[model samples]
Target: MLRKGLILAAFGLAFVAGPAFASAGPKEPRQASWSFEGPFGKFDQAQVQRGYKVYREVCAACHSMSLLSFRNLGQKSGPFYDDKYPNPNDNPYVKSIAKDYQVNDIDSETGDVVQRTATSADTFPSPFANEAAARASNGGALPPDLSVMIKARPQGAQYVYSILTGYQAPPAGLEVPPNQYYNPYMPGDVSAFYKGKGHVPVGGFIAMAPPLEADKVTFDDGTKSTLDQQAKDVVAFLAWASEPKQTERKQFGVAAMIYLLIFAGLLWVSYRRIWRNVAH
Candidate 1:
């Protein structure tokens, strides 16, 4: 009888503790629609442009995309590509964009560092002078580079979209630490901060507060700037920045597949014609 009672107590304890651990992980990321989902799908150029606007106006304040150059924005199938300009550096739009920002350079004649207007050939400059400066400005959290961020995280595009749009009031009985905001999409264990015996919490703490606001940026194309729209567009841009050649790669793959199929068919036909008379 005592053995049975002890067994029952163990099961009861497991049942009680299970709920707490169950909600310890972040909620599954919300699915977001993207234009470039399937192999043949292409990026929406307009959407990508809008996404750049979001990054320039908001994300650029912290994150740096050092991998990209203004010239890349005017390359073939790029965001601001103009067919007339095969050389991206010569593209007027790219030049204009580069002119808006300043880059550090040393004067050829004098050895002093000087800030000069960026050119299409120059890579992006870091927002902070150094890593330590970056950390100090952002409350000890170094803002990550946005370049290729989509590839770095699992379900990255959707993850970004959810985080931007998923901020909500923290659940009751959960104590969020100072300088942190709760986000259901962020991965973390919340049981320690959760006071309830029922379920711990469904999300983790994030250092970044909600970055998107309605009408935060006025779109040049006149798309209504909702919170959801901003999130979707910026995610799209990051996805593109992660792999600008994705569309071209997909196109090449399709063409290669077609060519291979035709070659295989011709080979089969040749084999039948050559061996038909000798076959039993």
Candidate 2:
């Protein structure tokens, strides 16, 4: 009888505590120190191009984005959504720019353009392509698809920005505590994003391997940009990448809020009259 009572009490306590823990919204994602609000403020073509280079050169070895089309790079979905390339039938930029810009890999034997075309049958090409290959390349961390990453995780854009710039060394005498991850800016054990397996592919607060480095890539104006800047641009790119319809959503959300506020005011006025003299 005593055991039963104890079990019931334990269950009750668990039930009571569950919500408090669950509702504690995860740590704030790293926000790039940009001087603006909303996703549109961070859009920059140069930044996106640099970020694409970073992803291709360093982070692409492990992650695969099966969903994104190669043409998505310069399509209406890109940062410059105002104008699309003329021929969807043929990739003009790819053929023309190959001599100057080696943005993608060209197959030596078959002459295939790397990272081209989004097809139903083919999984998105990995920044690396295979699991063993990526792990061997990334020191055991597997980077995952960035395509839907902004939408998949909580506070996705902020998180992406945070993780990209989250690298830091732990204090001299303190070994990292168990189950607690390290993030330069974020506190606790959140790895960036995980690949399919129980692996900490990349992301969370303290990922083991670092994908982006400060000043590794530069802008056209001869300024060496920091990793934080690159990360911010990429986050903005990804945010836009996922939601081309973000402007519409915001407009609708504002309209909805206004409608609800008006409705609530009307309800209050109606309730006041309905119970005017009935208050005891």
Candidate 3:
């Protein structure tokens, strides 16, 4: 009884402190509901495709998705995947998309490196030749790759969506440094109250300007391309990119849970039967 009481006391204290600990972090990120959120959640294919369009037309100019390949885009789990094109390698649409980019390759006959039309097997190429060129073009700030961006950031998809839509005029009396844009969502300088305290700013002065705007990309599905809509869609796509197997993982988890419950029940029944003839 004493041990149980101590455990209950500890739990009570934890319950009381939970909100305090949660509030200690930097401002709470704006929450956005995603189709692929809960256990039974699934990706909205149309939104994913629209988001991909946004990434290709706008975000691709500065950011690189180095870890993704054209073939991955047509996998069964991908938004663009179609039963009609089961094999991404032979998919006509994938082939057409790959042909737009120039990839570096070794010449077959010349024995030298040359730029060739990209194939479905080729990974998405970087916009600039190297990091130096990328920095030079973007005023010394390196644009992060979007391959695992959803997984990389805290609060994942919601944080990204907030950052994309959070750009605004700095609050009164805050001096935003040159070349530094003000965004409440980006981990930047702290408020005046915590100036000299031990709290150091985590994220500040983002280099890339606001990338999304109203009607920035035309959606083939006829959805109005508002700023928030674009942010939501692209973040959804990034979430899928980061964890393509999320749905499968959840499905497996459900099965495992059911199995464990059944096993536990059987064990309990066997224990009761075996001890039925004996005394405690």
**Highest TM-score scorer:** 1
**For candidate 2, lDDT tens digit of each residue in 154-264?**
777777787767666543333454434555444443232221223222222443455667776665556577777667766666665566455556667778999999999
* Candidate 1: segments with Cα more than 4 A from true spot: 1-11, 21-23, 107-112
Residue 192 lDDT (model 2): 24
Decide which is better by TM-score, 2 or 3: 3
Q: 1-280 in candidate 1: lDDT tens per residue?
A: 9999999999999987888756567888899778888988888989999998999999998899999887888876677878899999999999999999999999999999999999999987789988999989887888899889999988999888888899998999889998889998899888788886687788898888789999999999999999999999999989988888889999999999999999999999999999999957
Model number with the top lDDT: 1
In candidate 3, how many clashes are counted? 2
lDDT of 3 by residue, 200-239 (tens): 3333457889999999899998999999999999998899
Runs off by more than 4 Å, candidate 3: 1-26, 108-111, 190-203, 266-280
Total backbone collisions for each predicted model: 0, 14, 2
lDDT of each: 0.89, 0.56, 0.82
Task: lDDT winner between 1 and 2, please give it.
Answer: 1
TM-score of each: 0.93, 0.55, 0.80
What's the true lDDT of residue 102 in model 2? 24
